[model samples]
Target: MRELRGPIGVAIALWAVVATLFHLYTAGFGFYEPRSQRSLHLLFLLPLAFVLYPAGASSPKDRPSVLDWGLAALAVAANYYSYAQAFRINLRFENVTPLLWPEIVFGVVATLLVLEALRRAVTPVLAGLLALGILYLFATEYMPGMLNYRDMSFSEIVETMYLLNGMGMYGSITGISATMVAIFIAFGAFVTGSGTGRLFHNLGTRIAGRQSGGPGKVSVISSALFGTISGSSTANVFTTGSFTIPAMMRAGFRPHFAGGVETSSSVGGQIMPPVMGAGAFVMAEITNTPYSSIIVAALLGSLLYFFMILVSVHLEAKRLGLVGCDPSEIPPWREVLKDIHLLAPIFLLLVLLMMGRSPHFAAFWSIVAVLVVSWISPRTRLTPRKLWDVLVQAGNNMVIVALACAGASMLVACLTVTGVVISVSTLVATLADGSILIAGILLMATTLILGMGVPTTAAYIIGASIGAPILIQMGVPVLSAHLFVFYFAILADATPPVSVASYAAASIARSDPMRTGLAAFRLALAGFVVGYSYLYTPALTLQGPVLEIVGQVLVNVLGLVIIAAGLFGYLRSPLPMPLRMLLVPVGLFLTLFEAYSVWLRIPVELAVLAGLAYWPTLLSTPAPVRGETTRRAESAPD
Candidate 1:
């Protein structure tokens, strides 16, 4: 094992160097031919998958035995043969002839390789799911319900898998991954290497480190910034929670509360703008919307999510009598500025994106900017060795995502081949009976359920393919349909029973996993409002008139504050039960729907304000017995 390690590492290192150059030229400068670019993308995966083999196999039980290696080798050979056949067919323009022997051979091998790689990289559950999908595809004639289809010949299946058809792995999934997604992953690596992550953490700490429940609030803010860029809930939790959770504990928060706060905040990252995981890029490609618009919508959701967290933290602080960190302990402003240059890449990327450039170009240049800027400051300089390490690390990181994309592509291919997406869409529309509200709820549930175990990008892609069509057909705008599915897909990270983000936090805090998951759900209630609001208030989506948008934004923000206060059970002090319960429903109504009549909403709005104002006063005034005691004490003062 040790002898093979050196050669494998060297080979992986060489792949990184070549892939980096390829990405820079193709993604950065946009100079590669289409076929050449696709070939490079496929070749880049070989060394990456090999290098990750060891790390992904930590336990003896996980070690790939001789049989496993043989199967893997056979699979790779099959995949290559398939690609070669597909390339030939592309060259010939022969109307997808199923008599293609090379195509059949390639399909069989490629399927085996993907299934084995999935087993080695992800989980058996995913592998099982893929196997079931393939089996069902082959046995379509025997299946019942919407799943039944005419039995495809072996050549027909091979043609679907290998040819330049939409069902093949080289379609949209890999298309998006090789272009936009890969560039952004590189962009994130560049930014993290440049120390922008630390800058965000420091800024969050400086702004929110010295108030009641300050540490918890800081966690919310810092995790949001980190997650927005990193776009993985588990990564977000580990990155920001390491500091924020400890700080929250020191500031008198229970372990469970601290963990829940970090978990809930971190999960919001996949829905945050700019670098929002690989899903945002896929969202743009699938919906035909500008990447900038998706980023804006995600940013709105992120802002509302973090605001809810802040309000909850503030109320918790008041209830618990927690104090902020000492002023002397806060980092100096000038010191923070020393690392401010780290932010240049992100700002530059955003500006370029807003100016209508491709995300690939934006990410490529942003990476260049980070490397160049880091060289200017000795404190952030990346030496040749470090640069190589970064490349290797980036390549390694791309493997799981790349494989998942490949697997998801199969699912997409199957859906397209069977026309299952249209079938499912029609089924959902029928079930909802054309009610947008009912359709939205059912779609949301489907997204969250499917997304629980899958990566956010894969889940979002699948959800958008199956669910978005239904919503769009129901007269929902394109952006709203996509965004709605995307939001619920992200919510799966924090959703109960299988909340991966909450589990990460639970491990860190040594708290009960289920309890932390429940707490996270409570902390993230406002996200539900934001998700539903996208359906009702198109203005919040920047789709309507400016005045109407402003009004929607104002009402949404106000409603969020009220809901946060109610959920946390405190405004100025412990809210009386009656007012807390009253505010919860009122806030939900105003936040979820802008269609409420003025006459109906005005009365509820007035009642909410009255409750907010009177609750504190009612709590502050002394009882008659307490007043009598105070008078007696004054008369008998020493």
Candidate 2:
């Protein structure tokens, strides 16, 4: 990102502030017609991307170069034309009318500019996917069997991807970005500007500072809280992990383990309720489900996700004989409680969401509540300068997401026009041979592969566009299918080789990046199983009878405890290797096999695992391993 000086910097800042104000205004009042609203959104944001994100690493970092200005001018021209013609374009039957020369020229310009801006702001993966999508349009005639589709002409492709109101840069995906997601991003900026992130950290340290593995637990707690508003996992890791990872190392955690704990916790925040990053809004849009219902359904799985991480931290702490920080060094709970009013905006947002208000409506009011609550305590107040910064920062933060939505819209347009979505669904369903489990496994692998190196929102969008339909074809509920893809897309952040969040935490902890990635992947294994279980039984998502939901919750909790013990190699005491190895499969069976009576399985599984975990204490005190003394070395500075 650049740091321009003189009039250029001021002008860029004003553009960003205006973009933010546009979303805020529409959110509180009413939105314009769809194309008008979405086009105006792109008009504001795409040009900002051209100025802010350099074309390459060698590109000018301090100011816009000639090419940057030219690109910005082109972006402005294209999006402005789209905005001016939005109403007239919407009235015409798309692809039926021959394109006017000006529409063709601007359409082509808008498409290329959006793709180039996406490549600059985000990774090139989505752009690469768009390239492949267009290639597929031409290649469809040559595809064999279920992969085949009718060939589309080049002009039709451009019209569908650009001029069509529901398909391309102006599609529903961009619509979500322009409205609901944009409002929430602003809400996050306001919340952070009000010092809520600091409040969460102090509150977490106060509440969990005295527990076993307290520093590690604090990471899990604080990251989860901060992750709510800071929707990006990498951002969450850098913000919370900067403090938590070092604290964990100081409290006797190995550097890699500390990185792993922070990575897993931060990723979980993307799946956390109320504001689950940008993906949840896209999921709500794709599934045509209410945003409130999506969050409610996701609540149990998210709670269980945190439960697994905490249990892993506790067990690992116990195994390593780690203790809490000195009480004198920790803040008293009373001091932390004074800033609790900072959380009121989040609570108000949740209440409004539950009351069935539109997401943009809820977010706008929450932002107002943040400004009001910030003033109640001067320490956390947002001044005029801070408010301006928040507005600019919100626009800056929104660039990647808004462009991502626009980019993914082009890809979805390709798949929809070519009929590849349905074809791929049929192919996967056939490959599964009528087994939902096989279908799920295939799609999960696909989602993980697609999610690697991609942001959660884009990953989920691509995964859902291709993967969700496959599961739905095999009888999975719409909500269940999209969420299944959603979970794995998030899990990809900690998966090795391309674990973006883990590598981020590793940089902070000064650990080997790959080792930290592996540790995070291991810590987050429960999330994978949870995704699978939900696919088989919707009860895990609170979609079944009351008793079934209650029973599944209890059963799953017991199952996770067993799995955590096995993974961390501890429970009541050091577990024998065979017993620890055996616990994992048994726990998985209990969690994954939902056909048995939940009432019957809960007690049986709990007893079996509890006895196994506790048996070592009954036997006798186990001898300490060699080098135990050396393993607990004090943390080293980066």
Candidate 3:
């Protein structure tokens, strides 16, 4: 994005403040009628997205063009129609309103604007996907196999799409985006602007920067911290990667390896609670589970995912004989931590959430607490200028997310209206026969394919609607199905070719993007496996007794370690090729044991123990290292 000068800058800034204030007011008091609240929500985002993100990279980014102004005015007119006549529209829909030309024109214009805004904010892939949703509605009767359904008329599609609570723009979990996700985005912006992000990075460096794999570990810790709030893997990469990626590279990690570590670690943010990514919010809404419950269930899974990344980087560092950063270069703990109150809002946010406040309530109060806490010290205070930046940044980030939700909702509207979602679910069940495991695998593949190249929240919206229903039909837990799709949706950012997170980190690390993506996928392997773990062992999702949950979780953690050892070719010492191959199935079998009977599990558990006993004996001879990296190699104790 470019810096707008003079009038344009002031105009954008004023609108941004108004939008933030509007949300803050409602969050403090209460929401307007659902339609009124959501329409106004989009009213704020649509115009800003057009002005901030242009038609293309070749267009002016920061300044609005004549076409942009027209889109902005159209956004106001389209959503305003819904806002102004909410009661009338509600009654009309209730009366089974017929096709109207005005509604049709508005819907056509509004849908086109939404698609274009999404194309600019996210990627063109999402815009194209959303456009297909409309086509699907009109073309459903022509679809082959289970996907075929009766088509809807064009006028009906238009009527259903134009309103605040319309099928296309408002329902199917988009409410979570308009409410919880928007507030959280603002909360994140305030936290970041108040310097809490640096505090996280500094704290990470203090804890991990002196280890042999310090830089990589620091990246994991810091990215996880920042990601919980930022929720955008690409944003997290740029924020934390600027420091961590360079530190890793300077600490002797190969550029591609460094970028991969950053990419995978940053993606972990969406899985981390108290604020998991946008997907978690939608999951809570769709599954009808408490947000706290969702977060609790996600806790173990989040740990397992990041723990594997930490272990992979450590093993790689060990195998390659990498070392920590210089002591002189490391920031002193006292200096870095002096203004730690900046993180108080995060703690408060979590506390309020655990206390059963609405997620938006918690987020609102947290933002308030941020404002209050930042006043404690001038160095950390949110000055007026800084606060303005926070509002603008919040509005900017939220627009992208809101637009992504709109695009995803277009699909949800199509699928729900056309009954194609059910057909897809039925098709999967048929393909899998009577086996739940096969059904789950098929759903995972479907979600994984659809999730790639989409935003986390949007990806989950589309993938879960299509995939989660299949698992539910197979009698799997609702939370399990949503969590399953959520995991894959977040993972799509690390998958190769179009791995946006990896590509972002690669640019920062100055590495080959595809190599970084492939390496990220490899490092994130445990995530893929664990997505299935919770399905087989409900204990992993905290569905069982406390002891059983602990036991199951521990077993899965150990299994992840064993798998990482095999894939990364290291533990205490490097494993030879054959041992690496042997360890793979040993890990896989042990994981399966947790979900199997004792008669079968005990034998598998012992087999793993046997490998554990023998691994150290066959350890490969380690090579020596040279240069600055070796200077502080002794800093980390064996």
Best by lDDT, which number?
Answer: 2
For residues 1-638, could you state the per-residue lDDT of candidate 3 as single tens digits?
55776898988878988888888888878988777788889898888877877787677765888988899999989888768877776667531668557777877988999988888877788888888878887887898886688766777778667653645786645566778888888888998999888888888888888888889999999999888888888999999999889889989999999999999988989999988798888888888888989988899899888988988888899989988778876789787877698878888988888898899899999999999999998888999999998898888788888888878887788777777788777778788897777887887776667767678888888888888877776777889878888999898889987899998999998889999999999888878877887667687688978877766766777777888888888877667799789887878777755456534554565566566657676464555576656767768688
Superposed model 2: Cα runs more than 4 Å off:
142-147, 617-638
TM-scores of the models, in the order given: 0.91, 0.95, 0.93
Q: Model 3, poorest ten-residue lDDT window?
A: 593-602
RMSD of each candidate?
Answer: 3.8, 6.8, 6.7
What digit string (tens of lDDT, one per residue) describes model 2 on residues 95-189? Answer: 68888888888888888888788788887887888878878877888988765787777777778778888878899999999999999999998
Kindly indicate the candidate among 1 and 2 with the higher TM-score: 2
Pick the TM-score winner.
2
Candidate 1, residues 1-638, lDDT tens digits: the string is 11234654486467766766666678855744444454356556643453346424443333444554565466556545544544565575533444556556666776666776666665455566667777767898887888889888776665565455444566667777777777677677667766777788788878988888888988988888887677678878988888888888889998888999998898888777788888888888887888988887667667877788888888888899999876765788997898888888889989999999888888888888889989877778877877877776576566667777767777777777777888888898899998889988888888888777777777888888888888777777788878888888888878898888899998888899888888888788878888887776677677767877766666777787788778778776677688788788878987676567434554566567666857667557665774788788889959
Each model's lDDT: 0.75, 0.88, 0.82
**Candidate 1 Cα deviation (angstroms), residue 26:** 1.4
Candidate 3: segments with Cα more than 4 A from true spot:
164-166, 593-638
